[model samples]
Target: MKTVEKIERKLPVLKTRKRVAAYARVSMESERMQHSLSAQVSYYSALIQKNPEWEYAGVFADYGISGTVTKKRDEFNRMLAECEAGNIDIILTKSIQRFARNTVDLLNTVRHLKELGIEVRFEKENINSLSGDGELMLSILASFAQEESRSISENVRWATIKRFKQGIPNGKFTIFGYEWQDDKLVIVPDEAEIIRWMYAEYMKGASRIEIGRALMERGIYTRQGKPWVDSNVKVILTNITYTGNMLFQKEYCEDPITKHRRKNYGEMPQYFVEDTHEAIIPMDEWQAVQAEFKRRRDLGPFGNKSLKLSAFSTKITCGCCGKHYRHSGKRNTAGEVYYVWTCQTKSQKGASACHSKNIPEKMLQNATAEVLGLDEFDEDAFSQQIEEVIVIGDDTLTFRFYDGHEVTTKWQSTAKTDWWTDERRKLWGERHKRKDTNPNKHLFYEFTGFIKCGCCGANYRCQSGKRKDGTPTRSWYCTGPKDQCHNPGIRDETMKRLVTDVLGLDEFDEAAMDAQIENATILDHTVTFHFRDGHTESRDFLDKRHGTPWTEERREKARESMKAAWTDERREAMSERIKKIRSEKKWPNP
Candidate 1:
C-alpha cells in the first residue's frame, strides 16, 4: 500500500462554514439603550465576519419591547425561524435575560433549538446551549429575571397608590374641562362655564340629549374636537370631578403580561379628594341632581320618556302592545286642549302591527281619582302614589299603587262616535249641522289590554274591520319592531284560540287570567307560560335563531383567539401542572 502511493495526492475535503446570528434587545427605548443596541448589532456583525470558520447570517434587535414575551418580539422570532430552517448554526445573544426573561419560554425555545441541532451561546453567561447543563442554568437564571421584572412592576404600582392616598396626582391626565398643571387640576374658564350651564339646565328639566343638541347647535365641540353626543353630555354631568372632587383608582391594569385595563369597581380601594379644584357646580345642586337621577331610575321605563314631561304623562302602559302610551293633544276649537294617550306601537308601527286604540287621558284620570277615593286627584299626589296604570282592552285600567294595592276599573270607550252614528245623526247632526266636533270612541274587543303579547309582554291590541253593513270584524297582532323589540308578533285570533282551547277559559276572562298567570315568555322554539301557582307549560314552535351565517371576520377572530389562548407559556404551565398531578396520583384502571 505504501509503494503504490508514491505520487503526490490531495485528500483534503471542503467543510461548510457555520452560519451564525446574533440577537439583541432593550426593554425601554431610552437614548442609552438605543446606543447599546446599535453597538451590539455592529459588534455581532464584525465578530461573525472576522471568524474564518463562521459565516455572517444576520443580527436581530428589538427595541422598546419587553424581554418577558416572545410573541411581540419580531426580530427574535425571525432569528428563531431562520435557525429552524437550517439557515443558522448558532445564535449569539448578550445574555439569557436579553433572550427571554420568562423561564418557561426560554427553556422551551432552547430545547427546541437543541433538537434541531442549532446552538445558542450566551456571551455574558459564557454558556453553550448544546451543553447538557445549559437548560438547567438558563431556567434558574431566567426565573430570577422574571422575578426582577415583576418586582419593578409591583414597586411602581405601590408608589402610584401611595401618592394617590396623599392626594397628589401621579401623572398628568387630561379631561374635558380641566388640565393638570404641576399635579394640580386647573379648570379652563371656558370649559368650566359650559359645565356650569349644563348642570343648571339639567336641574331646570333639560335632558342630556337636549343639552348635547344645544351644544352641537352652538358649534361647541368637545376637548377632543369631536361632536358631543348624549353619552358625552351625561358623562360630564355625572362626573364628580367638575364639582371640585377627584376620584383615584377608578381603573387598573389586570396584569403585567396581558396589560389589560379594567374599571375598578370595588375591586380595589378608591380615594376621593374633595375641593381638589375650582367647583363648576355647587354641592347642593350636585346632590339634587343625584336625587333626580335616582327618582327617574326608580320609576323604570316611564321616567325616561322626556325631561320636560309633566307629571302622569306617559305613565300609562298599553297592556295589549306592552308599550307606554304616548301623550297626545288635540284642540277642540273651543280653545280647550283635550289630551289622550295613544298606543306608541300602534302609532309608530301602524294599526296592522298594534290594533290598540287611543284612550282619553282625562276620562282615565277621573276613574283613577274615584279609585283613590279622592274628590280631586292632584297631579303631584297621583304621580307619587300611583306605581303604574296598565290599560287592557279598550276600557279596562289596572292601577297598581305604591302601597302594593291593585285596582281594576272600567271606563266608557271614547271610540264609539255618537254624533256620527246613523241612528243618532238625525237628532244630533241637525243640531250641530250634521257634524259633531267631538266624537265618541269605542273599541271592538275588551281584551286589547287584557290579552298581552307573550313575546314582548305588550298588551294585545284590538284589530277590527268595517263590513258594508258597518258591523265590526276583529283580529290581533304584535308591533314589536316599532318598540325596538325582537320578539315576533302573534295574531290575536291565534292567541285567543290557543288560550281558550288549552286553558279552557270561559269568555277568555282576562281579569281571571291576570289573577292566575304570572307571566308568559316566548323563545325561538317554545312558549312558556308561568302561572301564579308556580305551574309551567311549554309549547313547541319553529326555531328562529338559525338565520344569519357566520361572518368571515368572526371566523378569523375565533382562529386568532384560539391560537393566543394556546401560547407556549400557557402550554408549559398546563404541562407542568399535569406532570405534577401525574406524579402525585395514578389511576388503577381506566
Candidate 2:
C-alpha cells in the first residue's frame, strides 16, 4: 500500500518563543552607577526584543541595593514571582554577583528556578543555571563574591578604627543640638539654647519628666519635630557631647549579614574626644548633674523622679521576705481611702510567696512616734532618728537607728474601727436594710452583717437557691477563699434559731435581736454572740440541711425525669465524651 501511495505529507511546526527577563543592580547610590543601571536595563530590553527566539519579559533592576540579601530587592523579587508563575523561561543577569552575593541564597534561588523549568544565564561568566555544572560554578563564584564583600566590610571597619584612634569622627551624625557643617559638628543656636536650659533645670533639681512636660507645654520639639519625652530629656541631660566632647563607638554593628547594632559595654574600644564640638552645657555643670544622678540612684525607689516620696518610702523593710515595703492605697468598706505598706513580694506575687501582713500608714506613724517617745508623729524627727523600720510580724515593728540603737514596739492596727465613723455606720445600716420584696427578710436577713466567720475573720456571705423540689433554700458560708478557709456552711434556719435561743426570744424578732446583739462569730461547732451590753454567750452550732426531704415518691419522680433526659442521642454523646476523657486520662476501658 505504501508503494502504491508513494506520496509524502508534511506538517508545519510552530516555533515557540522563550520568555526572557533580565536583572541588574548596583550596590551603591551614585549618579554614575544610576546611569550604568539605566544602560543595563536598556541593553537587556533591546537584546531580548531583537532576538527572534525570545519574547520580551520586563527587565528588573534594583538600584543602590545590596545583592547579599534578596528580600530588599523589589524588582528582583517580582522577576522571581514571574518565573514561578511560568511566565519567564530564562533570566539574564550581568553576573552571578549581581544576582546574589550570598552563596546559599544564590544556590537556593537557582535550584528553585531550575525546578520550575526556568534558566538563569549570566552574561559576564557565560554560565547557564540550567546546565549540569551550573550549581557547582555558582557556589564557587558566589563564595568568592561573599568573601569579597566581607573583605571590603573589614577594610572599612579597620579604616574607621584608625580614624577613631586619631580622634576623628567616622561620619557627621544628626545630633539634637548640633548640625554638620564642613564635616564638623556645628552648634544650632536655637537647639543649643534648649539644651542649656535643660541642663540648668536638671541642676536646679527639676526632674527629667518635669523638664519634658515644660518643653511640651511650650510647644518645643526635638530636631526631628517630635514631642519631647522623658527619655529624650534624659538624653540631653546626660549626654557629655553637649559639653564640647564626643564619645565614639558607644555602639557597634555586631553582624554584617543582620546589621544588628549592640551597645558597647566594654565589648569594644571606645574613644572619648574632648573639644570635638562647641559646648552647649558647661563641663562643670554636667559633672554636677551626673553626681546628682548617682545620689538619686543610691536613694533607690524613693528617688524615682515621677513618684512623690513619702517619709516611709524605702525606709520600711519586710523582715520575713527581706524585700522593701511598697506603698499602696486601699478603700475600706466605708469608702474611706487609706494607705498601707505591703511587702513587695506579697504585693506582686501574692501571699503564698510572702505571708507578711500590711501595716497601715497611720499605724506605722503611731509606732514610730511611740518608739521615738514623741507626743505626735514628726516626719523630720523620724527621718533624723530612724534608719529603717523592720516589720517583724503582724503587729510588731523593729526600728533601727542611725546611732546603732534599736527599739522594738508592739502596735495594733485600729484601721478597721477608725474607718467606721458614726455617719459611716448609719450609712452602712441604711445600705444593708432589708428590701420589702423578700417575705423572710426579717428572719434570716438581719443575721447577714452580724454573722462573721472566726476562721478567716470574714463576714459570712448569704447564698440563696432553689432545691430539687423547687423550694427556696438559704445558707451562709465564709466569704474567704474556699481552698484556704475550710469553714463549714451553716443553714439560714439554723443561724436564725441559734440567734433566737441566744437572745432568749420566744420567736425571732429582728428589732430585739439588733437591740441586744452587737455581733456574732461562728467557730467550729460553736456560735459565740457578743451582746451590746458587753456580755458574750456561746452556743453549739447545729449543722442542719433545710429542704424538702427526699421521699420515695420524689425519688421515683427524679428517676422518671432522668429517664426522659437520657435519650439515645444524649446517651451516645455522653458515651463519646466519657471515652474521650478516659483516653486523655490514659485509663483502661471498664
Candidate 3:
C-alpha cells in the first residue's frame, strides 16, 4: 500500500463546461438609457463569450422595461424558459435591483434556477446561488432592493410635494389656455378666449354636453386633436387652473406594487397654489361657477326645470329633517301633467326618514305669491324679502323673512289640474323636441363653446359618415394638420353621454347648462375640462371595435387561418421581419 501511494501522481481534473447566459435591463427610454442599455448588453455578451470554462448562451436584454415584475420583461422571461429547458447551466446578471425590485420575484426565480441545478451569479452583490448561505444572503439583499425601490418612489413623491409647496412648477404641465414655457404656464390668447367663452356659455346656462357639441361644430378639437364632449365642457367649467391657481396631489398612488392611483379625497395631503399665473377666468366668476355647480347638484331629483319665473321654484324646504322638498311630476284623470313637492327623504328613501305631507306646486306658488305680495312668483322679490320657507309638518310651513320675522301658515293641497293647457303641453313638447333635433343636443348639459386640440390649438369640427347599418353617424374631426396631429374624431353622442354621466344630472335644463362650464381640452381618448368653478373633470372615449375580444377557440381559428394563408416563401419572408418587431413589445403584450 505504501509503495502504490508513492507511485501515485497528481493529474489535472477535467471541468464540465457551463452553458452561460447573461441578462441586462434598463428602465428608462431616454437616449442616455439606450446607450447605457447597449453598453450593458455588450459588456455581458463579451464577458460570457470570453469565458474559457463556459459555453456562450445568447445574451438576454430588456430595454426601457421595469425589473419589478417578470411580466413585462420579455427577454428575461425567454432566458428563464431556456434555463427551464436545461439549455443554461449558469446565468449572470448585474444586481438584485437590476434583476428584480421585488423580493418575492427574485427569491422565486433564484430558487427555481437552483432546483434545476443552475447557478445565478449576481455581479454587483458578488453572490452565487449554489452556496449554503447564498439564499439567506439573497433574501436579505432582495429585501433591501425592494426597500430601496420604495424609498426612491417615496423620495420622488416627496420632491413633487415639496415643489408644490414652493409653488414651483416641477415640470412642463399645461392646460388648454396655457402652455409650459420655461416651466411657467403662459396663456395662449386664442385659447384663453375659448376658456372665457366656455365659462360665459356655462354661466349663460349651457350644459356640458351641449357645450361639447357646440365646440365640435366650431371646429375646436382637443389637445390630441379629438372632438369635444359634454364631459370636456364640464371639466373646463370646473377646473381651478384657469383661475391662475394650481391644486397639487388631487390623486395619489395607493401602493408601490400595483401603482394604483386613487382620488385624493383626504387620503393624502393636497396643495393649493393660488395666483400661480395670469388667470383666464376671473376668481369671482370661477366662484360663481362653483356656486352654480353646487346649485346644479342641489337640483338632485327635479333634474332640469324650465326657466319660468315662479314662486314655487326652489322655495320649499323640510324644517323637520332639513331637506329640500323635491318637485315630482304627477298625472291627473284628464291626462294632464301637474307637479307637487314632497320631502326628498320621504320621496327617495321612503317615509321612514321624513313623515311629511306632499304640497301641491300650485298651492305653494299661491302661498308664496301671497306672502311676497305679488300676483306671480317674483324670484327677485322673494329673494330680497323672504329668506327660506321651513316645513315643520306636512301642512305646516314657517316663512322666515330676512327681517327676522317668522310667519307660520297651514297649507292645504288644492287641485291645479286645470293649469295644464294644450299651450302648456306644446311648451313641454317643444323642450323635448329641441333636445332631439339638435345633433349638438346629444348631451343633456347642452352648454356651448370650448374644447380644442392641445397640440395645434385647432378647433374640432363635426364630421358625418354612414355606419354599416346604413345609418348616419356624427364624429368630431380636428382642423389641425393631419400629418402633425394624429387625432381621430370622437363620436358626438358618446362624448355627450359621458359628460352627462359626470355631471350627475337628469335631462331638463336646456338653458341652465351654459352657465357653469369653462372649457375642454382633448388628448388621446381623454377630454380634460377646466371649469369656471375651479374644478376639473375627465372623460374618456374608446372606439367601439366591431368584433369582441378573441376567445381561446377564436384564437385557434385565427392561427389556423394564418397557417392556411402562409406559404413556405411567405413564412420565410415573415421570419425575416427582423427582431426589431419582436423587441418592440408593447400592448397586446404577453
Candidate 4:
C-alpha cells in the first residue's frame, strides 16, 4: 500500500447581507393620512438601513391609494417587481391590511413571495410570512379588513342616498354651460348663448350633427376643449338643468370593489328639484323642444334632418320578416338612377335569411296613387293619410290608413320594359361588345367560356398580365362570386400542358383540342376534360408559376421587395382600393 497524506485547502468566505424593502400606503388623500404615510416611509427607511444584517433596497410608498386592489398602487407594484427580480429577501409592511385588504389578493401575494424564498414581516401583527402559521393569521385578519371596508362603503352609500332624498346633489358636477359658484349652479354668458343657439337650431329642424358641424366651423368646442359632437349637442338640448331644474342620481356606483358606475334606469329612485338654478330657457320652450323630439322619433330614421326624406322611406314594411324596408338605388345602363325598396334583412343578410322581393320605387308610387284615388302620387296627401304599406306575398300590397281603413291592391312589376328603354338597350349592347385589346389574347381566348368551375358551375374568365421580365402571362379563373367558389386560377401554360398530356399529343394543338374535347372543368387540384365521345379524363395540374427558376433565394428576395414596397401610404391606398371595390360590388360594409 502507498503512503497516504492529508491535504488541507484554505479559501476565503464572503458574508452576504439580506436585501430588505419596505412598502407603505394611505387609503385617503387627507392631510393627516399624507403625514402618516410620510412617517411610515421614513421609519421603514431608517429601520432597514440601521440593521447590520440588512442591505437597504429603498422604501416604496403609495400616497392616497387603496390597498384592496394592488393594480392601482404604483409603488406596491414596483416593490413586487423588485422582489421578483431577486433584489429583495424580506419585505417590511405596516400590517396585513396595509399589504392588502382583499383576502384572496393578500393570501395569493404571500404564497407567491413564500415560494420565491422571500419573507414578509408585518410589524403591526408581529408575524413573519415565511413561518408555517403566518398564512392562517393573515387569512383571518385579511377577512376582517375586507369586511371593515365593505361596512364603510355601505355607510357612505347610505349617507349619499339620504342627501339625494333631501334634493341635495352629492357633489358639484361639470356641465358645459354652467359652473359651480359657492355651491350653486351659475350659467356662463357665452356658453349659455351657445346653448340657446343649439335649442333654436333644433327647433328650426336642424339636426344635431349639423349644429355640431357649425360649432366646429366657428372654432367653438366643448368644455373639455375638444371638437363638438352630435352627443354633445344632444346633451345640451335635453338637459333639464339648463331650465333651472336638477335631477339627482341619474347614475350611481353599483359596487365598491369594481367601482362601476351604471345608469340608474329605474334601478334606484331619482330626485328632481325645480328652481334649483337660474333658467337659461323658459320651461315652456323646453317642453316644446321635447315634443318636437318625440315627433321626429316617431317618424323613424328618415324623420331626422340628416337623411333625405322619401315618400315611402319608413312607410314600407316587409310582411314576411316584419322588418322595415330600406331604400336602395343603382344606375341603369342609360345612366339613369333607379330606386327600389328592399327588406332590411334581405339587404343585410342576403336572400337566404329572408325571401322578400325588391319593390320598384315607381311601382310603389303607382300603387299608392291608385289606392288614394289620385291620378299621380302626392307626397303631402300620402304622408297625412297613409300609415304604412305592408308587402304581402309576391305581388300584393296592403295599405293601412290612419283612419282605420285598409286597401289591398295587386301589383305587377314591369321592370323589364321600364328599365330597358331603346337607348338603354343600345348602351347595354355597346358595353357588352368584345372590348379585349390584349395582343396575346389568342393564346387563351379559346378556353374562355369553355372552362367551367367545378365548385360553382360558373364560366371561367381569362385574365392577362405582364411578368417582371416583360413576358406576357395569361390565367383562367372562375367568374363566380368568391364567397361561393374558391377554385384556384390555372396558368395558360399549365392548361395547355394538361390538355396535351390528356390527349397524348407532342404539343398543344388548338384545333385538335377543340375537335376532341367539348369542355373542361377546373377543380381545386385536378382538371376534368370532357371528350366529344361522352367520356372524361382527369389530370393533375401544377401551378407553373411556383415551379423552377423561382428558387428559395429568389422567393426570399421577392418577399423582401414586397415588404419594402408596402409602406404606410401604400397600405392606406390598398385599404381605399378595397373599400371602393366592395362598394362597387354592393357588398355589405364589414
Best by TM-score: 4
- For candidate 3, what is the total of clashing residue pairs? 59
lDDT of 3 by residue, 1-590 (tens): 35544566789999998899998898889999999888988998898888899899988999888777788899999999998798999889898888899899999999988999999999999999999999999999999988887888899888988888897766776578888777678899998898898888878877666677788889999887978876677778888889989888877888775567898889798888888888999889999988987887787423333233345445678876878777778875335677878888888888887888888777877778877778887767876888788887657778989899888878776653556568867666444433333344666334223456766767676677898889997776677899999775677677677666666767534344445555567888888777678898888788775567779998999999998998999878886574446667532424
RMSD of each: 29.5, 16.8, 29.3, 22.4
Clashes of each: 21, 0, 59, 0
Q: Give the C-alpha miss distance for residue 368 in model 1, angstroms.
A: 23
Model 3 worst lDDT window (10 residues):
301-310
For model 2, how does the per-residue alpha-carbon lDDT over 117-221 read when each residue is reduced to its tens digit?
999999988999888898888888889988887787788889999999999988877789888889788889988888888888887878788888899999998
287-370 in candidate 4: lDDT tens per residue?
Answer: 999999899889778668787659787789999999989888777544568888999999999999999889988889989999
Winner on lDDT between 1 and 3 is 3
lDDT per model vs. reference:
0.76, 0.86, 0.78, 0.88
Tell how far residue 231 is off in model 1, in angstroms: 6.2
- 246 in model 2: Cα distance from truth in Å? 2.6
Candidate numbers, best lDDT first, in rank order: 4, 2, 3, 1
Error of 4 at 510 (Å): 42
Q: Which residue segments of model 4 deviate by more than 4 Å?
A: 1-9, 80-89, 107-119, 127-135, 165-167, 298-300, 308-590
Stretches of candidate 2 off by over 4 Å are 1-16, 80-87, 111-118, 297-301, 308-590
Model 2 clash pairs are none
TM-score (C-alpha, index-matched) for candidate 3: 0.46
